[model samples]
Target: MGQNTNIRGIVQAAVAMTTVGTLTAVSATVSRYPVYGGQAVRYAVAAVILLGVARLRGPRPGPSARWEWPLLAALAATGLAGFNVCIVEGTRYTSPATIGTVVGSVPVVLAVAAPLMEGRRPAARIVAAAAVVTAGAALANGLGGGSLPGLLLALGALAGEVCFSLLALPLLPRLGAVRVSAYSAAAAVPMLLAAGLAVDGTSVLRVPTRGEVAGLGYLSLVVTAGAFIVWYDALGRIGADRAGLFAGLIPVSAVATTMVLGLRSPGMAELGGALLVGLGVIVGLRRSAERPLAVAAPADHHDPAHDEEGHQDQAHDDQHPEDRRFVAEKAADHGV
Candidate 1:
């Protein structure tokens, strides 16, 4: 099971890299489109796609409590709206490479925050790997000139990236990955629209060009709707600390996209950074030989048909009470 989880994490990480990398490349077209306007369109379309997916998937496979709404809203606000706004607004003042370098520290942020949030220090090797990933991000992005405002905006983006996964952990057992993703995207639409109106004025209401529309579609459907589901699913399976390290691949993927698009060939720094990010992923994903997972009790002690579902339940139960409360609240709805 651990091996399978690691494999899934690797696949999910690849998907995430592809998602953000495509965003980096596609965003070049948005130079003509107002940033906020582009984001508003992206989330709106994403919400629509997610809503359809939610409907098709039927009701979530478990009971739910209304209390999960606030967490979902926060996830939408920070991860979807605030994060994109920071990147877009930040880019106006600084280069995308600068933004990428700042955002690349997401694993480090998660590693540090894990102790505060979960009351356990991350593995030393994991923290070291995260640092290596951060260094790779800087090198791959070729850290260069940036203003104070741009740096601050990039920090805001970093905050959003951290919040996205951390915020989802508490709700994973209750809502399931797809539903959590769907709800967040749906909730973010209004937030993004209001932000777009504030930032871009009447321009937000204008029809986008065909090229902009293409970019918007890809961002909405592929990056948001598709990537969010995969990311949260992997987070549930493998845990966030290990999964977050994979985020380092975003810069590498960006370099790959550039090479494919013939924008520019990667230099020594990019190649070396890509290798470091790969090494970090390998080191971070390795399970400790001395600290094997506790063996589960006999099947007779659990529901025979529910063995698969039990793992996810145990994952949630291992969290802090604050993290477990959402599940407890929803379990109460089922009288469990």
Candidate 2:
């Protein structure tokens, strides 16, 4: 069962990488539209897609009580709006590849925050591996060159991602990954729109070009809505930290896509960076073995079948209120 849980975690990580691909595409495509107008278009489309998904997930009368609501809002807000701001604002200082390399630092951020999020003492191996990954990210993105600002932005984004996921943990059990993600995406829409209005004024409301429309469609349907659902569902089954390790693949896939389409060519530095990222991933997976997970976070509320037979070091006993609460919390925790 533990092995299966790990495998599911790997699956979730892979799905997460795929989701990030869609996001990266959306980011590049949005560039085709005028600055402010493009952002408004992106959010308007994302909002509609999330609204549809919210309908399918069904709504609860109130917010998820699994955690304090305000904290959860901050977490969701970071992912939804903060990530965007970081990327957009961060880009002003750096190139996209530099962003990728910096974004790759997420594993390190996860490793750092893991203690707080899951109550686990990170092993030495994890620390070493995280260092390697960060180094790889720096090299991959040309940190020594004019890419310094971009690298900083990328690191900031990585940090934001770490905060978003860790802070989001408590909310998962009750809000469900679907509702939580949808609400986050939905909330970002207005803030994004406001930012767009501030920058582009009435221009943001104008009709988009054909390329812009295509980009919008791709982002709304496939990237934001579809991939978000898949990624979070996997999160429910597995756990966030495990799910994050797969992010190493995003830069690889992104670079490959561009190369294949003749949009860009790979240079020696980029190739070396890929090698470092690969090594970092290998080290990360290895580190997971050296240390026993200190604190078992919990399970997903969406699937009771995932509950371990002897969960929370307690036998299942309906008569005991404490035991029942343990099981309930375990079940809702979404394998955190």
**Whose TM-score is greatest here?**
1
Number of the top lDDT candidate: 1
Q: Each prediction's TM-score against the native?
A: 0.84, 0.77
The worst-scoring run of ten residues by lDDT in candidate 1 lies at 292-301
Which pairs of residues clash in candidate 2, taking residues 3 or more apart in a chain or in different chains?
A: 299-333, 299-334, 299-335, 300-334
* C-alpha lDDT values of all predictions: 0.76, 0.61
Stretches of candidate 1 off by over 4 Å are 61-66, 290-336
- Regions of model 2 farther than 4 Å from truth: 22-26, 57-61, 64-69, 144-155, 236-238, 287-336
Residues 101-141 of candidate 2 have per-residue lDDT tens digits of 66777767676666546544455666566667666655655
RMSD of 1: 6.6
